[model samples]
Target: MKEALKSFFGLDDESDDDELLSKNLNDDIAIDPDFVMSTDMLLAAIMEAYRVMDRDKDALDLFLTKYEHMHENESLRLMSEKKKKDPSLSSMHSSKEEDKQRLVQSANEALRTFFKMNNDEDARLLFRSLNDSSRTAETYIIMVGGLVEKEPWSGEISQLYQSAVQSKCLTEELAFLAMKSVVFSKLDGKMRVLRDIIADTSSVLNISPEEFNSSRYWQLKRTLGYRFAKLLMWWRNLSSSWEKELKLSVRQLKQGRQGGHVIDEDALRCIVKFAGHNQRDDINQGVPVSDGPSEKDQVIQNKERKYGIKLIREVVVDAHQTTLYNSPAFVDDVAIGFCSLKAYDECIKFVKEMHSRDLIKLKQSTYEHAIYAAEEKKDLKMVDELIRNMEDGCSLNIK
Candidate 1:
């Protein structure tokens, strides 16, 4: 046994045998066949061997089992040591809760080891068994972040996200990760996954007012709204009708607004573009369908476009009021939306407001809209002034 211990620890010299023997046993234990290594000592050796061999899961199992049996043989060993030092200390031993915590700590370590190994399957399994105690949002982020690129594990990733949220371990960082992963996933029903993440994020944020107003929370909200709107546009064929899609888009926007989320520029642009673009031709190009929309359908279509542009205008004004709006591309998109509605005056007004806010160097589309608005009013002076501003922006390569 001493020789094996020496081999296990990589001690080859005969001189090390005495040292190894003394190292693993008490000074008073006599050398006899019956004087076997204590359970703790033996388990400790095996656990170390497993760790050295990179078998972290196996090491964790043995460690947990040690706690399970610690009440018997291990307690006596501990009591004996304490008694020798002081009689009063003998009565105090580690509680079961402490042992459980130790077990959890070891398990968490094993999880981190597997994560470093890139053995995601093993890490995921261990994470499932882990107690929420001592777990942080970063822990889930690391694991989920690793799995996001794996493509095939989308469902599992979603499940893990749900579990983390339920465990109250989901933070703004993790929430963003979950939403982005599901949005980019190749799997069908990505829309559903995104909605779930949005709902989960909102629910989690509702509990913490400070976090609810955090910059990270705002980022997630904007991303969620933008991605979902783009996704809805992609699923145009799946919608039973244009009006349904329109209602769904408006409904989602309302939810974001009611939930204290700012409907940022990208999301507003997606919805406006979706509402403005007619899918009647695209839907019927290569398939059998009615020649055109019914009169009622036409009115709904008009309402969809007008209502979407209205929302865009309202959100832009609100963003300006809050001083939270700044995006050149968004200005361009809103300009296009206004052009579609023939609200050229409103479009130029919006651009000038952005300019007055020092959001200068606007995009060419915004400048074009402002120029068109000037031409429509037969104001050549205004057009030349707009032309000068556009040239200055171009000289600076603003576009």
Candidate 2:
């Protein structure tokens, strides 16, 4: 080991100049991978010993300890700067702080390269080599993060996200960061990331019903809803029919492997709107594809309308089956979605049906949608009836 160290640093041990050489090597400016022990050689030796001894963690810990040692003094300088009160001391140590950051960053880069995470296939193989690899999240985050940088919206990103959540290695902060990355992926117009993240919603966002009232929750829901709408459009373009697209999109929304856990009403309504709009659009423009249909079929277009109604009903029924139906926004958003979809009769019918079911403590938006739908239909009597219903429900006696 001593001879190997000497050969690594081009040392002349016979000259009794060991102390001089060691001092020169230790100096901050001279400290580098080559003058110090060759990290490559050290790593190879450690790995060989580890393989023979049948150890993985110990070898990694050994490499980490040695590699991190190179930055220890610089890191300590940063801590000292943080603790010091004197302005002069802070100013004097600014350069040292920068150096410390650089040292730490360099160490991380070196670790990434050493672990072969800079190459995706190798990184994946390394993860798979571990038993119950998904639970190895703590060890694999940095490596996977580097891999994600190369392919932000790939199947691998979603897999890593799901694994990280499954492994319980995801902190709240990391969870939001990953979600934000998915939202930002849309700037590149990648719908797959949006769909994948939504598919992993229970793991990715995972907030409870209690926090539903918070502005942050609504904000996140709105952002997700908007993205879902865009994704709905993309799905529509990909499929031959709205039913196929809606089914595929619903499949994407299911939670865990069992396909339970419905998405909340706010985001679900976004999907509903797109499904209905395609029906309206197809009716207006004639069937996009030829299918043994007359002009009467175009006018009657009941298949698209029926499929839209079925899709929306399925979403609402799933919510009712789950605890999310109790959310106050549920009835309101569903009504608004129906109105937005121009299913005026369906919108009014939903309101009456929900009231009959007594499942809702109706919000003002529900009445507003009912009234708006009546007005659009030029049904004065229905408008008056909705106004009285709103007064009885929420005292919104609007003129």
Candidate 3:
């Protein structure tokens, strides 16, 4: 018995367990004829071995063997004629619930042991070994919370997220949870995550980038625009080079048929915010109110500022061409906005299109909008012509 204990735990004679009726196959074999140990002692020793000297697989095999023997013994004891005692007691002998709890406990213990054994490697490998695709996704979902905290940038975390997204057995809510990870990754500034999310989202929304960049996908474009606006607000004081990089990055994405569907009010707001002059006329003090980015290297700084403002403004609205409007319902306001943006030709073209589509009737507001558009062109002749047309169309004689 002492020898067996030593063999099991690499302990000496003072070690605990001694099992009788056990075969010793190590050739140094000996079975203790007089030794006796309780099942409780055996369970305790197995748990201890798990903690101290990891013979986890061996311990599990031994536990299963013990379980079969104990189950047989209990069956025999229950069937005995001497045990025909009490009906109530026999009814209470249903170990199903206990068996369920034991199985759950064993599963938890196995997971603990497996995870503890394999920290440095991807834990997905363990699930793969178990051949459990659904469980793999579930485990990845749980692991992501911690991974997002510790190593959010890890490629392994990304792989796990991808697996969860591709899972076949996911519930709708679970699938959304996986997509939420992709959104967070984009918010974290991962272009790869952003691209994947955009592709999936476009597929679900039945939109392609070709139709997306015009007037088609306003809502989706606005969502991304809001996110970009928040980022631009944070970039208030960064250098001109950074600003240029940001603009160029967006342009590259747009040209590549990626990023926001179209630049709308929200996106324009972001651009305007970025291109704002930090200084304002303080009429009260009769001087300039200046903040952020001192006037050092005035030549280079002024050049960049002028170039940036002009560049981004043109990117949003071109004075030489008709600007695109998102929706046809409020396109009159869009036409006026284009006029305000100095896009006279675009304003004229837009109003013409709206009239052709019967979207804007020949009414007082239509004449007024046409007048505004013509006035932006700085042609008194065109403006007078529109006034005469307005009088003819609406039959208003107001001079």
Clashes of each: 0, 0, 1
Model 3 lDDT at residue 186: 33
Error of 2 at 84 (Å): 50
Worst-scoring 10-residue span by lDDT in model 2: 283-292
Better of 2 and 3 by lDDT: 2
List lDDT for all candidates, in order: 0.56, 0.51, 0.43
List where candidate 1 sits over 4 angstroms from the true fold: 1-141, 150-246, 255-261, 264-266, 274-309, 321-324
lDDT of 1 by residue, 45-97 (tens): 55555567675544544444343343454466576675687454434444433
What is the per-residue lDDT of model 3 for residues 284-306, given as tens digits with 9 covering 90 to 100?
11112232365664554455445
What's the TM-score of every candidate structure?
0.50, 0.35, 0.28
**Model 3: clashing residue pairs?**
322-346
Which lDDT tens digits does candidate 2 get at residues 230-298?
343443453444454344455444541155655544445445545555444342221122322687766
lDDT score for residue 371 of model 3 = 70
Stronger candidate by lDDT (1 vs 2)? 1
Between candidates 1 and 3, the one scoring higher on TM-score is 1
